[model samples]
Target: MNVLLLNPDALRGSDPAYPLGLAHIATAAMKAGHAAEGVDLFSENCPETAIFSTIESFQPDVVGLSVRNIDNQCMRAPIFYLETAKNLVHTVRKRFYGPIVVGGAGYSIFPREALDYLRADYGIQGEGERAFVMLLEALEANSKAFSFPGLTRRTADRVEWIPNVPLASLEGVWADRSLFPPLPYLDAGTRQFPVNIQTRRGCPMECIYCTNPWLEGKTMRFRGPEDVVLEIRSLSDNFGIARLTFVDSLFNHPTSYTETLVDAFLKARLELSWECTYNPRFHDPHLLSKMHDAGCVRVSIGNESGSNLSLTALKKGFEREHIERSVLDAKALGLETVCFLLIGAPGETKDTVLESVCFLDELNPSSVVVTLGIRLYPGLELSSIAAKEGMIDPRQSLLSPAFYLPRELEGWAESFFLDEVLPSHPNWTV
Candidate 1:
């Protein structure tokens, strides 16, 4: 079987994320004796013609499209991305007659809807490496692959989704670096950001607004510490890529796993600098020290709010004190700390928003990223709350843009930040 994987993400606001998921699928499919190639649309000029030319040359038996994000996740200026995926599907169909398959972080969140909307023949929801290989095998056998876990299909009347079995082992699944273009050059100040690598999958945190639990499962699974170090070393040696960002939902969770990985990195003595999203609730001096020694240059704390009222309303496990300590402790360790805060949640108001701003002033991080409204996902608690509060119709498809912002705080949260807090605190941005 010949498979051509397509990465349709072109948004470069942040660093151009290496298509890690597509690379993994390509690796898995190739390992199973199938010819696989990954083409990043962002890296190529004339992407539309590139797709047609690749199809003409490769003549693949299957085309797999990876959708990284459904949207920008910005409530203020939301950019819906399913249309892009749909366009890619149409582009591939224009020249090729093959089974079109789709999967990725964005696709897994709403697999059935994405498949139907993109008009693809199939989609694998959760972990794509294993499920995708099985899909190829099933296709080769001319048997039904829809029953396989994490696979979805559409019929004339309905869409069917196969529940994925939780893959606990990270033994052989790895991202093939050669599938992507060489790492781009960055200046000294921003060079710390590099291509992303994942140490694990899944999240246990039950933040009300988060879709990580729905996307990656709730329980955490980790790659072996030595395996992580080995992959890092390979990246450094083969590609001269030293800096990386661990794109895990939460990096420092399950302290034992983090400690082992950090220890491995230290023992290997790799000249590396990295950053990760940290949940402040698990901040420990020993762990922080180990991470610093292991070349962790920065910590992006996922403390979404500075006010306890908002924290409780959002079901953030940690409180304001936890965030303060996490920031102060990371700063003390000489690790640059970046704090993320959400402005308008369920209980957000003038007083609570001010309280959060004041708290940020007290424990000043290296910088603060403030987002205005919470983007609502399909199965999250925030969507339920939105429907119950009459913010959106219950029958509405969240596939389009939907956000949870208090009606009372309408026309106030953005003004307050842009007018007062942003001016006083140069470190804060929306």
Candidate 2:
């Protein structure tokens, strides 16, 4: 069987992320004795034509589309990406007559709904490396009643989703490097193409508006630290890429594991400068020092809110002091710190917002990202709160974003952030 993996993500406002997940699936498919190819639309100037040409050239038996993000996730100026995905699906269907399967972080968040919305024939939620291979084998056998985890089938009336997939072992899972975007970083000027690497999957933290726990189960699954080093080494040796960004929901959780990985990196002397999202709850200066010594240049702390009232309201489990100490420790080690502040969550008022801004001012992170409102996803506590407040229908397909912002804060939040907060703090961005 021949498979074509397509990455339809072209949002390049920030650093354009490579389709690492699709590459993993493509590699898995090839290792299973099937021919696989990938078409990355991220760097394409003409995506529609490129898709048509790829289909004409590859003529794959199955097409897998990886949807990385649903919306920009910015409540102020949200850009929904599913319409572009839908158009891409339509284009592919018009050109090719094979099955279309959807996967990736965005699709995994709303598998059934996304499959239906994109009008794809099937979808594999969660990890797709093993499940995708199983799906291909089942399809090759012309077997129906797909019983694999993460597999979903769509019919005329309804979409049937299989059980969520267990965490896949990273023993031999790797993305095909040859299919990656070309060098010189086209849109991202002067920014080194830091390859995105995932050392683990799943997040245990249950933020009120998060889909990580739902998309990837509450339990964390880690790849061997040695295996991670080997992957990084391979990418550096083969592709001349040294910079890496660990895309785990929270990379430095389980302090012991993180310290172990850091020690391994230092022992290997890989000369790889990497970064990751850090959980501020565990503020260990020793760990921060080790990370800096092991070539960690930056860390992003998604503290969400600096106000304890908002933090407790969001069930973040950490208070302002944790964030402050974490930032101070990282700065002491000369590591660039980026703190994420999400204002306008439940229990957020003008005073709480001010408290958060003042806290950020005191912490003095290298950079601060502020988002105005919480985008509510279905099946989350925020969704229920929105329902209780008559903000949205609980049963509504959140495929289209529905946000949870207090009525009183409306018209005030946006301007306050734009005019007052952002301008006052040179480091702040919305």
Candidate 3:
């Protein structure tokens, strides 16, 4: 079976992401003896004609759509982005007779709701590599697909989700790298750097706004440290790629595992610049100094909120003081540290936002980026909170942008940072 995987580049409130899940799904499909062609709508200019032409040429038996985000979380809202997605989906549907299956982080969270909203024939809820490939095999076999695992389908009356079994092992399948273009958005600081790798899956953190535990499941699975470093050596030595990013959800989740991996990188002396998110709790200044010696230049921290109350509300185990210490600690190691701040959560208020501002004043990170609250994600405590607080209309599709902040501080926090904090602190920007 030939599968055309569609990656729709919609607005994410977070980073401008690489399509990691789509690449993995393509890998799985190809490994199963099915030819998988990935068309990134972003790279393809979001045109119906280009998609139709590709479909006409490829003549695929399955169309798998990857949706990574639900809305434009940026303060600068691009008008009609959602409408564009709907139109593109509809246009693709008209040209292709194959079943449309939705997957990815955004779609994984609200699998049932998104499946209904998009009129998709099926949705893969959890990990797509296994579930999606399994479904493709079952569909080809003419078997009962509704009972296929980790699948969600809309029946006559209501949608039914086939629960995914727990993942018990980790397999390192070299991803189908051809689907991704050459690193297109490398920071100007390190454009000459070569190949990159995603060494792990799932995050152990239970931050309120995060969907890691639910979407990727509770376990933190990683490839062997030796294997990861070998891949890095191939990138730096053979591919002439000096910069690599480990796009892991929690790069430092298992303290022992990370220590071993960092040691592997040091032993290899790959001479590559790298950076990844690290938990402050596991961060020892000595360890960071070693990483810096091995060419690590920057560190990213998820000090999501500054208020202790907000931290407790969001279940960020660490406190304001921990963050403060972390900032000083990272700086002492000669590592440039950037704080990723989230202003709006359940206990968010004018005062809590002020606390974050004060934190910025004290730590004065090399950079800070702020995002407004996002409340539409399913399988989150925030989802229930939004519903209970009347922030989300029961009948309304939360698919469009929706958030939960203190009603009084609605526009103030986001505007204040853009107008005041970012301007005054040249280091900070959204």
Candidate 4:
């Protein structure tokens, strides 16, 4: 079977993310005795032209599309990305008459909704390496036994979903980077465009607004430290890539694993600068110092809000002190710190917002990313709370952008941030 995987993410002004998930699926397909090719729509000036050309040339038996993000997640002037995907699917349909499968982080969040909306034949909910290969094999065999984990298909009346079983280990699974070369992605962006690498999967945190647990599962799965370092070495040696960003949901969780990984980087003598997100719950100065020594130049802290009220409301297990400690420690290590503030959570108020602004000002991070309202997803605690508070209808589909902001701050928050917070803080971006 020949499989053609397409990345349908072309968000403007955002960094072009390497389709690592599609690469992994392609690798899995090839390993399972199938020919696989990948086409990145973001790399082409005209995505429709690229899609038509690829389908005409590749003539794949099956086409797979990876949806990276549903939206830009910005409350103000939000950019919905699914329309582009729908257009791509229409284009693919015109060129080829084969089964189209959809998968990736964005689609996984709303498997049935996205699949039906895009009018794709099938969708994979969770990890795609094994499920995708199985899907291809089943398709090749012309078997109707599609009752497998993470696989979804829409029947006449309904969309059937099978719960996904995440891979227990990531030992032998490696992304086939050849399908989507690094040069195209590297040349498309600035020098700071870091190639993304995932050392682990899963997040155990109970952040109310996060989708990591649903997308990657709650169980922590780690790849061998040596294997990860070798991948980095190959990237550097083959592509002359020096910068990287870990896409792990919680990079510092299980402090022992993080320390060991940092040690591996030091032992390998890889002269590459990298950055990763840090959970304030695992803030450790000693480990951070080691990471800096291992060529870590920056750290991003997802401290949604600096106010304790907002933190508790969002179910962030850490408090204001923890956020302060994390930022201070990273700054003290001479590592650039990027702190995120998710404004307008459930219990947001003028006082809480002011507290967050003051706290961030005191911390003085290298960069501050401010998001106006919390984007609500189905089955999330925030979603339920929003419904209860009458912010959004309970039956409303979140496939379209819906956000939760306190009624008092609806028209006031954006103005306040734009007028006061952004002007005074030169490094802050919304």
TM-score of 2: 0.96
Give Cα-based local distance difference scores for all models. Answer: 0.85, 0.84, 0.73, 0.89
Q: Point to the candidate with the largest lDDT.
A: 4
State the displacement of the C-alpha of residue 225, model 4, in Å, after optimal TM-score superposition.
Answer: 0.8
Candidate 2 displacement at residue 361 in angstroms: 0.5
Q: Candidate 3: what lDDT? A: 0.73
Q: Per-residue lDDT tens digits of candidate 1, residues 1-430? A: 9898898755755556778888788878988899977778866768888898888898899999998888888877788888988988998999988799999888888888888999999899989988999889999888853478998988788889987876878888687777664454343575544778898988888899888887778988888888888788888787778788899988988889999889888888989899998898887878988899899989999888889989999988989888988888889989999988787778788888888888887888899999988888887888999999999888777878788889877888888888978898888888
Model 3, 1-430: lDDT tens digits are: 9899876766433335557678778878888899878787655654676788889999988888887766565534533344555566797888898788887777776777777887788889887778888889888988863476688998778888877664555565445555754354344565663244777777777787777788777787778888777666655554466776677777766766777788888888777788877666566666667777777777888788788888888888788777887678778877788887776778788888888888777788888877766545655777778888888765665566666676877778768877877778888766
How well does candidate 1 score on lDDT at residue 242? 73
- Of 3 and 4, the candidate ahead on lDDT is 4
True-structure Cα RMSD, model 1:
1.7
Q: What TM-score does each of the candidates earn?
A: 0.96, 0.96, 0.88, 0.97
Summing lDDT over every window of 10 consecutive residues in candidate 4, give the lowest-scoring window: 184-193
Best-first order by lDDT = 4, 1, 2, 3
Candidate 1 Cα deviation (angstroms), residue 351: 0.6
Count of backbone collisions in candidate 4:
0
lDDT minimum window of 10 residues, candidate 1: 184-193
Q: List ranges where model 3 is wrong by over 4 Å.
A: 11-16, 74-83, 183-196, 233-240, 374-376, 393-397
lDDT tens readout by residue for model 2, 1-430: 8898888864866667877888778778888999887777766788888888888888899998998889988777889998888889898998899899999888887889999999999999988888999999999999866687888889999999986756655577666666654453433564466678887777888788898888777888888889888878878777677788888887888888889988889999988788999888866888888999999999998798889999999989798889988898899888999998787788799888889888888889999988778888878989999999888986898889888888878989889888887777888888
Model 4 ranges with Cα > 4 A deviation = 187-192
